[model samples]
Target: MLIDASSVAASADEIRAGAVSGIIFDMDGTIIDSMPSHAQSWVAFVQNHGIDIDVPDLMRRTTGRTGAECMRELFARDMSDEEAWQHIAEKEQLYRELFAPIFTEVAGFKAFAAQTRARGLKVGVGTAGDRHNIAFAFGHLKLPTPPDAVAGGDEGLAGKPEPAIFLEVARRMAVPPERCIVFEDAPFGIEAARRAGMRAVAICTSHDAAQLAGPHVLAAARNYHELIESKFLERLHVEPA
Candidate 1:
């Protein structure tokens, strides 16, 4: 059944007692501190291409979107399809270089993921990024395995607020949408979870907690530690590792 916020809040106690089986995580803002790196790369790419848009403006249009989708918005009417693709690829390559050294697991995220896996709950990734970004997330984080399944932009899934990527992750994990939970930092990602018929927890790794507020979000935490300590997972009925 679709549980409301208060019901979900109360259910955390039940979850601690034992209800959910899997988690779907968004890679960039939710799992790692990579959004700024992405923004910088985007600004440089647009500037180099002689396009003119600022960071805040870009953030609105770009955050939670695949590089290709962002390229479409920025280049759609202005450039040829091939040129748009090329620009997006070039921008992402630059992002990889910039993000390589700085890419590190979000606070408490690695431990939380290990804990979730140890409890036998499935893990899956849903991101609007490309394969290269996926590689960076796993490689940089040193995860033993690429998440059991991943939905990326190149896979042709619709982007955030569309529900396709999260739905795909649910399918790959063999979990029903209603029984799964999503962790995200974007408003769009939260909406995507709701659209997919899943509950979500928002993290304030990028945006402020107030900005990410929504009915679909069961709780919002500043970091993974806060999430774990606050009984966020336990409430979901996720067992201790």
Candidate 2:
């Protein structure tokens, strides 16, 4: 069932039951501030391919999709799947190099994640980044658990706005989809959470506060700290009597 206000109300009962064991996080804009790095990589990669595209426009296209999907959209010309994959791989390699230096977390992200684990929540990463990007993120972030589970863009799972990736993460974590809480930064990711029957809190790291407001998100915050402070975490519990 898709997550709606009524569904979220129902899920709160599960959270208080301690049946909700998992926390799913989006990698790029939600966990780390890497969206700009991706935008830069797309601009440079496309330029090298003799295609001059606006970085912002390219970023919008690629926000919650796999690199191959972005390439297909940008090329506009028909390409065999293999050719598209090859081009995306090259572009992602460039993105890795560009993002290596600034592998910083969103404000309070590491602490909040650690705390969530301390509270006995299974932490999972659900991302549209491919294997290489996932590896790069872990290597740079250097966390304790390295995510209890991960679902990547190339994992044969459907990409964001489809809910497959998040649902897969919950499945891998042995948690039910309705019990998973998704932390996302993109509009597509929010829609995915709703489709997966999970409540989503938007982390507005890349977008302005006004831009992040929408129906798909239960709540919106500027960063991890704000999310925690706003008591959106209470959504993880049943409404007090």
Query: In TM-score terms, which candidate is top?
Result: 1
The residue-by-residue lDDT of candidate 2 on 58-111, one tens digit each, is: 676668886567767889877876888899888888888888877788888998
lDDT of 2: 0.76
- RMSD (Å) of each candidate, 1 decimal: 4.3, 5.2
Residue 140 of model 2, lDDT score = 82
Poorly placed runs, candidate 1 (over 4 Å):
1-18, 76-82, 238-241
Clashing pairs in 1: 12-235, 15-237
Error of 1 at 155 (Å): 0.9
Q: What C-alpha lDDT, on a 0 to 100 scale, does residue 155 get in candidate 1?
A: 80
TM-score: model 1 vs. ground truth: 0.88
Per-prediction TM-score: 0.88, 0.86
Report how far residue 97 has shifted in candidate 2, in Å: 1.5
